[model samples]
Target chain A: MDTIVAILAAAIVAGTPLVFAALGELVTEKAGVLNLGVEGTMLVGAVSGFATAATTGNVWFGVLAGMVAGVLMSGIFAILTLNLMANQVASGLALTLFGVGLSAFMGKPYESVTLAAQAPLEIPLLSQIPVLGPVLFKHQILVYVSWALFAGVSWFLYKSRAGLVLRSIGESPESAHAIGYPVIRIRYLATLFGGAMAGLGGVHLAEFYTPLWVEGMVAGRGWIALALVVFATWRPARVMVGAYLFGGVTIAQFFAQGAGVTITAQFLSSLPYLATIIVLVFISRDMATIRLNAPVSLGRPYRPD
Target chain B: MRTDKRITRRITGLAVGTALGLALSGAAYSQEPVKVGFVYVSPIGDAGWTYQHDQGRKELEKALGAKVTTKAVENVPEGADAERVIREFAAGGYKVVFTTSFGYMNPTIKVAEKFPSTVFMHATGYKSAKNVGVVNARFYEGRYLTGVIAGKMTKSNSAGYVAAFPIPEVVQGINAFAQGMRSVNPKAEVKVIWVNSWFDPGREREAANTLLSQGADIITHHTDSTAVVQAAEEKGKYAFGYHSDMSKYGPKAHLTATTHHWGGYYTKAVQDVMAGKWKTTNVWGGIKEGMIKLAPLNPAVPKDVADLVAAKEKDIAAGKLHPFQGPVKDNEGKERVAAGKTMGDEELSKMDFYVEGVQGKLPKK
Candidate 1:
C-alpha cells in the first residue's frame, strides 16, 4: 500500500510539468499554430523564475515572473513567424538553441543556488486520509494549478463560444478569416498562452521539482511534453492522462529498484523512454482518430489571404 | 577518430612552429602576463565539477595576480564545439589551457598540436603528448571513506548510489563504496540508479526519493546536481555531496562530502608555465597529494565511527591503506584482486565488476 501510494505521488510530481506544456501546446495547435520551441521557452522560464525567486524570495512572484518570461520568449517567436512569416520549424529550432545558450549565460551566477523547498498544500479533510492523503492532497500548489488549468483549457477548447471560433479557425484559417475572424491575432494569443504555460513547466522544475539550478535541468522534459501533445491528439483531457502515464513510467525504474528487483541500470533506465515510445505508437495506430482530432490548420501560417 | 588525425597533423605542424617560436622567445622573462584558458563541459555553477575548476582558477589568479591572467568559457559541449573553443583560445594567445572534462581529451590534444609553445592539461583523461599532460584525482578514496560512514549509519543495511554514467570512473566509485560497506557490515548492500546525464536535477531527485522510499537511509551520487543531497534532506535521510561541499544545500542531511582541491595544482601549473619549467606530466594525485579531501563530517555521526573514518582517511593519504586492496571479490564471488596485491591504477581505471555487496550487475556500456 505504501509503495503504491509513493509511486502514485511521484507520478504526479513527474507528470505535472508535462501536463502544463502539452496543454499549452494544445491551445496553440488548436488555434492553427505549432510552436516547436517549447523546450527553449521552458529553459528561459526556468532561469527567469529561479532568478526572480532567488532575489525576491517570493514564490508567487517568481512563478509569475516565469510566466512573463515565457510570454516574452514566445513573443519573439510570434514576431519572427507571424510578422516576417519565416519558416516555423527552423524558427522554433533557433529558439531552442537561443534559449539553451541564453539561460546558461543568465544562470551562471545562480548555479547551485536553491530556493526553499516549496511545501505541499494539504486539503483539510483529505489530509487525514491514511494512504491517499499524502499521495493525493500533499503536493506542491503547482499540481493543483495544473489540474485547474486542464479544466479551464478543456472548457475554452470545447464549451466556450470563443473556443468554437478557435476550433473553426484551426480547421480552416482561410475560411475563418473569410468569415470575419482575426486569425493572426487569435494565433498570437494562443502562441503567447503556450509560451506562458511552457514557462510554468520549466519553472516548476527549478522551483518545485528539484528546487535548484543546474545547466539544462529541464533535462528533455520539454521534448517529452511535445510528445505528450501528439499522444493526447490535441485534447486537453488526454494531456493530463498522457502526462500521468509518462510520469508513472518515469518513476517505474525507482519502483523496480526500491522493490529490490535488482535490475541492471542500463535496462532499467531505458524502461521509461521505451514505455513512452510504446504509448506513442499505440496512440498513433488509429490514423482516422488522429485525423479527426488534429487541428486542420495546425502548423500552417495564415497571412489573411 | 577524425580529431586524432587532426591532432597528429597539428603536432607535425607544431614542431616547425615551435622551432621558429623558440628563436623568437629566447628572452627568459617577457613583460606580458601569462594567460591561461579553461574549457568547461558544463556551466561553472557554484557547485559540481566545473565550479571546482573555476574555484581553482580564482585561486590561481589570487596566487599570481600580476604574473598571470585567466579566462574561462563555461557550458562548452565536449564535441566539435570543444575543438572550436580550444582552437580559439590557442589562437587568442593563451599560453596554457585546461580542458576540465574527460570528454575534452581529444579536443585538448587536437588543440595542443597547433600551438606547441602552449601547455595543455586535460583532467580525468589518459592521453598525453609533447605539450599535453593528464591529471586526475583518486575520487574513489573519498568514496570509500563516505561508504564507511554510510555503512555505519544505515538503519536498513542498504545504501543507495545515484550514478551519472556507466563509465569506469563512476563504476569504480560504486565498487569502492560497496567495498567500504561490506568491510563494515557484510549484510549491507548498495543499490544504484543510473541517470546517464551528469546534471539532471529532476531525475536525480526522483532517484534519491525512490532510494529513500525503498529503504536506503544514506544516499550518494556521481551526478553534478545537489538534488541527491537535497532529496535526502527533504526525506530526513543522510547523504554525501560530491565535487564540492554541499552541506549548505542540505545542512542536516549532509554527512561528509568528497571535494576536489585543484587550486594548488592550478597555481602550480601556471607558475610552471610562467617560469618555463612546464613539461608533459601525468599527475594522479589523491588524498596524499591533497588533491582529494573530505568535507567536515556532520555531528550526527557517532564519535567512534567518525574517528575510524578519520583514521582511514589518514592511512589513505599516507599510502598505508589502499581502497582496493587484495582479497577483493567481484559481486559473483570471483576474486578480482588477489591477497597481498592492491588493485593498480590501470585496473581501477577500467573497473567493470560490481564488488561484492552491490545489488546489480555492472551495466555494459
Candidate 2:
C-alpha cells in the first residue's frame, strides 16, 4: 500500500510538466493554430530558467525567465506562420531544430551545475489524511500549480465567454472573421500561451524535477507532451489523465524492474509511451467525439487581408 | 616604353623578394603544430564520461602548448552523423583523431581506412585497424573499491545500481560492485535498474528513488548524469559516483567515486604519433597504469573500511588482487571461474550475466 502511494506521488511529480505543456498546446490548437514547436519552446525555457535561477539564486525568477523565453520562442512561430503565411508544419519543425541547437549552445556554460532541491509543499490539515494526503498534498509547489493551471484552463476554455469565441474561431476562422472577431490576434495570443506553458514545463524539469542544468536535459519530454495533447483528443481533462497515466506507467516499469521482474529493460523503458497511447486510444474511440473535439482549422495559416 | 618596362621589372623584383623572405621564415620554423581532433557522443557536461575525455584533451593542450593544437566536436550522434564527423576530421588534416564513445568504433575504423596516414584512437571499443587503435580504462577496478565502501556503510545490507544499458562495460561494473560488497559482507545484495539512456536525469532520478524506496540504502549509477548522486543526497542515502568525483553533487550522500583519467594515456598516444612510432595496440589500462583512481572516501566512512579499501586498491595496482578473482559464480549458481582461476579480458568483455549478491535476472537482448 505504501509502495502504491509512493508510485502515485512519483507519477504526479512526473506528470506535472506534461500537464502544463499539453494543456498549453490544447489552448493553441483551440485557436486554430498548430504550433508544433513545443519541444523547442520547452528547451529554451529549461535553459533560461536554469540560467536565471543559477545566477539570481531565486527559483521564482528562473520560472519567470523560462515562461518569457518560451513566449519569445513561440512569438517567432507566430510571426512566421501568422504574418508571413509560412507553412505552420514546416515552421514548427524548424522551431524544434532551432530550439535544440539554441538550448545546447546556451546551456554549455551551466552544465553539471546543481541547485538546491525543491521541497514538497505539504498542505496543512489536508496533508494529515492517511494515504491520500501523502500522495496528493506532498509535492513540489509546481505540481500544485499544475493542478491550478488545469482548473483555470478548464474554466477558460468551457465556462467563459472568451472560450466560446476562441472555439468558434478554431472551428471556422472565416465565419468568426466575418462576424468581426480578431482571428489572427486571438491565434497569436493562443500560440504565445502555448509557448509559455511549454516553457513552464521545461522549467519544471530543470529547476524542480532534476535540479541541474545539462544540455538536452529536457530530453524528449516536449514531444511526449505534444503527443499527450493529441492522444487526449484535445480535451483539457483528458490531457491531465493522459499525462498522469504516462507518468504512472513510467514509474511502474522502474518499480517492476526493481522488484526483480524479468521483462526486457528496453521494452520496459518503452512501456510508458505504449501504455499512454493504448489507454487514450481506447477511451477516445468514438469517431464523432474525436471530430467534435479536434479543431477544424488547426495548422492552417491565417492571414487577414 | 623603355621606362615602362623598367618600372614593371622593379615591381616584379619586389614581389619576388617578399615571397622569398616569407618562404625563408616558414622553413626556419619547420615544425608545425600537430592537429588533434576529438569527437564526443555527448556534451562535456560539467561531469561524466565525455567531460573526462574533454579533460584529457585539455591536458594534451596544456602539456604540448605550442607543439600541439586540439579541437573537440561534442554531441555527435553514434550513427551516420558520427561517420560524417570522423571523416570530416580526417579530411581536414587532423593528424590524430580521438573518437570517444563505444558507438563510434565502426565509424572510426571506416574513416581510418579512407585516411590511412591519419591515426585514429577510439575509446571503450574493441575494434582496431592498422591506423585505428583502442583505449579503455578498467573502471571495474574502481567499482570494486567503491563497492567495498558501500558494503560497509549500508545499514540495510542492500545497494542499488542505476545503469544505462546492459552492455559489457556496465555489466562488468555491476558484477564487480556486487563481488566487492559480498567480499566484505556476504549478506549484502545489489538491485540493478537500467534506465536505457546514457544521460536522462529525470529517468535516472526516478530509478534511484525507486531503488531507495525498495530498501536500498546505498546507490550508484553508470549513466552520464549526477542525478543518482543528487537523488541519494535528497533521500539521505549513500551513493557511489562514476567517471568523475561527484562528491560536490552529493556532499553528504557520496561515499566515493570511481574516476577515469585519460590525460596520461592521451598524452602518450599523441607523443607516439608525433614521433611516428604509434602502433595498433588495444590498450586497457587500470590502477597500475593510473587510468582509474578512486575518489576520496567520505569522512563519514568508518576508518577500518577506508583502510581496507586502500589496501585492496594497492593489491589491485600490484596485480595481487582481481575484482573477478577465484571462485566466481553467476547469480544462477553456475561456476564462472574455478576456485583457483580468475576471469580474463575476453570473458569480461562479453559479460552478460549478474554475479552472486545481485538481485534480479539480467534482461536478455
Candidate 3:
C-alpha cells in the first residue's frame, strides 16, 4: 500500500510538467496552430528559468523567466508563420533548433549549481485526507496551477465566443477569415500561450523536479509532452490522464528494479520512452478517425487572395 | 566574320569581369576575427564531461591572452549538422576548433581534412589526423582511488554507481572502482545504474534514489549533475563526484570527488600552439600527472578511513600499487589480467568488464 501511494506521489510530481505542456499544446492545436517547437521552447524555459532562480534565489522569478523565454521563442514562430507567410511546419522545426542551441549557450554558467527547489503547499482539510492528501493536495503550487490552467483552457476552447472562432479557424481557416475573423492574430496569441505553457513545464522540471541546473536537463520531456497531446486526443481532460500515465511509467522503473525480476536494467529504464512510441502508434492506427478530428488548417499558412 | 566574333567575345568577358569583382570584394571582410569553435554533444553546464571541456576553453583564453577567440554551438546533432558547424567556423577563419564529444570524432576528422590549416582537438576519441589531436583524462585512476574509499567506508557492503551512457570511459570507471573496492574490502560489491543520458537531473536523481532505496549506502556517479549527491544526502548516504568537485552540492554526503583538471592540459596545449610546436598528438594524464586528483575528504569521514584511502592513493601514485595488478577474472571466471602483471595504458584504455564481485552485467553497446 505504501509502495502504491509512493508511486502515485511520484507520478503526480514527475508528470506535472507533462500535464502542463500537453494542456498548453492542446489549446494551441484547438486554435489551429501546430507548433512542433515544443521541445525547443521548453528547453529555453528550463535554462532561462534555472539561471533566473539561481541568480535571484526566488522561484517566482524563475517561473516568470521561463514563461518569458517560451513566449520569446514562440514569438519567433509567430512572426515566421503569420507575417512572413512561411510554412508552419518548417518554421516550427526552425524554432526548435534555435531554442535548443540558444538554451545550451545560455545555460553554460549555471551547470551543477544546487539551489532550493519549490516547496509543497498544504491545504488544511484536504491535506488530511488519507491517500489523496500527499498525492493530490501536497504538490508544489505550480502543480495545482497546471490543473487550473487545464480547466481554464478546456472552458476557453469549448465554450467562449473567442473559443468558437479559434475552433472555427482550426476547422477551416479560409471560412473563418471570410467571416471577418482574424485567423493570424488569434493563432499568434494561441501559439505564444502554448509556448509560454511549454516553457513553464520546462521550468517545473528544472526548478521543482530535479531542482538544479544542467545543460539539456529537460531531456526530451518536451518531446514527450508533444506525444502526450496525441495520446490525449487533443482533449484537456484526457491530457491530464495521459500525462500522469506517462509519468507513472517514468516512476515504475524504480519499482521494477526493486521488484528484482531479473530483467536487464537498461531495458527497464527505457520503458517510458518505449511506452511513448507504443502509445503514438496505437493512437495513429485509426487514420480516418484522426483525419476527421485533426485540425483542418493545422499546419497550413494563409495568404489573402 | 572573325572581327565580329572577337567583338562579341570581348563584351561577354567584360560582363564576367564585373561579377568576379563583386565576389572578391565580398571575401575581403571575412578575416576580421580569429575564431575558435566548439561543437558539443551536451551543453557545457552539465558538470560532467562538457563542463570540463568548457573549462579547458576558458583556460585557453587565459593562457593565450587575445591570440585565441572562441565560439561554441552546443547540443549539435552528431552527423551532418556537426560537419556544418565545423565548416562554418573554419570558413569564418577560425584558426583552432575543438570538438569535445565522442560522437563528434568522425565529423571533426572530416572537417579537419577539409580545413587542413585549422588545428582541431577531440576529447576522448581515437580518430586523428595530421591537424587533429585526441586527448582524454585518465579518470579511471582517480575512480580507483575513490573506490578504495568506497570499499573501506561502505557499511552495507554495497556501493552504487550512477552512470551516463555505457561508453568506454564510463565503463572503465565502474570496472576500476569495483576492482579497487574489492582490493580493499573483498566482500564489497559494486552495483551500477546506467541512466543513458549525459545530464538529466530528473533521471540522475531518480537513479540515485533507486540505488539508495536498494540498500546502497555509498554512491558514485559519472553523470553531469549534483543531483546524485543531493539525492544521496537527502537519504543520508555517502557519495563521490566526477568531472568537477561537487562537494558543494552535497556538503555532508560527499566522500571524495574524482575531479578532472583540464586547465593544466589546456594551458600546455595553448602555449605550444602559440609557439608553433603544437603537433597533433594524443595526450593522456593520470594520477601521478596531477590531471586527476581526489577532492578533499568530508569531515564526517573517519580519520583512519581517510588515511586508509590516502595510503592506497599514495601507493598508486608512487607506482607501488596498480589497480589492475593481476589475477583478474572476467564474469565467466575466465582469466583476464594475469597475476602480478600490471595492465599497460593501451590495455586499460580498452577494459571491457568487471573483475568479479560486480553485481551487474556490463551493458553491451
Using TM-score as the measure, the top candidate is 2
User: What is model 2's native contact fraction?
Assistant: 0.67
lDDT of candidate 2 over A102-147, digit per residue (tens): 9999998888678999888899999999999999999999998999
TM-score per prediction, in order, is 0.93, 0.96, 0.81
lDDT of 3 by residue, A49-137 (tens): 98999999888899999999999999999898888988888888888888878987787777757776456799889988999886788
**Residue runs of model 2 more than 4 Å from their true location after superposition:** B1-30
Q: How should the candidates be ordered by DockQ, best one leading?
A: 2, 1, 3
Residue B35 CA error for candidate 1 (Å)? 2.3
Candidate 1 Cα deviation (angstroms), residue B116: 2.2
Candidate 1 collision pairs: none
Writing each residue's lDDT as its tens digit, candidate 1 over B1-365 gives 99999999999999999987886785544866898999998777788788899999999999988888889998888889999999998999999999999989998888888799889999999999999998999899999999999888898999999988889999989988888877888899998887767878898899899888888899999998899999999889999999999999999999989999998999998888878888889998989988889999999999999999989999988888898998998889999999999999889889988888887666687
Sorted on TM-score, best first, the list reads 2, 1, 3
Regions more than 4 Å wrong, model 3: A1-4, A105-109, A122-134, A155-165, A174-185, A254-266, A279-292, A302-305, B1-47, B53-100, B107-122, B127-134, B234-236, B263-283, B330-335, B342-347
lDDT value for model 2: 0.92
Candidate 3 lDDT over B120-191, as tens digits, reads: 888889988999999888888898988888888899899888888777778788888988888889998877
Q: Which residue runs of candidate 1 sit more than 4 Å off their true CA positions?
A: A127-132, A258-262, B1-29, B274-277
Residue B308 Cα positional deviation in candidate 2, in Å, after optimal superposition: 0.5
Candidate 2 at residue A77, lDDT?
A: 96
- The numbered model that scores best in DockQ is 2
Better of 2 and 3 by DockQ: 2
